[model samples]
Target: MAEKKAYPLRIGADVLEAMQRWADDDLRSLNAQIEYVLRAQLRQAGRLRPPVPTPAVEEKE
Candidate 1:
């Protein structure tokens, strides 16, 4: 498994509350919600790299 990287993030209370609400509504963890938002913004800004394909899983009896 890849090692996880961590960063310290600072946000205004209002913005944090809004993100918390959105995360809850979407059934996503707060970290995931933040990542999703950041990824979308980066994509829109043309700063995103090409996506790598994930391996497919097979079902067994």
Candidate 2:
């Protein structure tokens, strides 16, 4: 499993409520909802960065 970085976030009450409502409607957890929203915004703005460290296969000795 990949390690997750934790950070503190500050959101206004109205925005928080809206996010909670969106999460409920989408049947997704709050964390996933936030990630989805951010990714979509980045993609729309063409600011999404490419993934780093191309995947590679390992061979056994």
Candidate 3:
């Protein structure tokens, strides 16, 4: 996992309340919901790279 940085954000009260409701509906924390929304937008805009898949390990019998 990568280290995370904390920054203060200024959001309108109505927007924050709406986001809180959305986060609850999605069973995510407010911060995580915000990140998810931003990541989705970045992906849509071709600004973020797609995640690479890991190779599956073989099981020895």
Q: Highest lDDT among the candidates is held by which one? A: 3
- Model 1, stretches more than 4 Å misplaced? 1-3, 55-61
TM-score of 2: 0.71
Better of 2 and 3 by lDDT: 3
Give candidate 3 misplaced runs (Cα > 4 Å). none
> What is the full ranking by TM-score, best candidate first?
3, 1, 2
- Model 2 has an lDDT value of 0.89
lDDT of 2 by residue, 1-61 (tens): 2587898899999998999999999999988899889989998899987557768889999
Candidate 1 residue pairs in clash (backbone atoms < 3 Å)? none
Worst 10 residues of 1 by lDDT: 1-10
Q: In model 2, what lDDT does residue 58 have?
A: 93
Clashing pairs in 3: none
CA lDDT of each prediction against the hidden true structure? 0.91, 0.89, 0.94
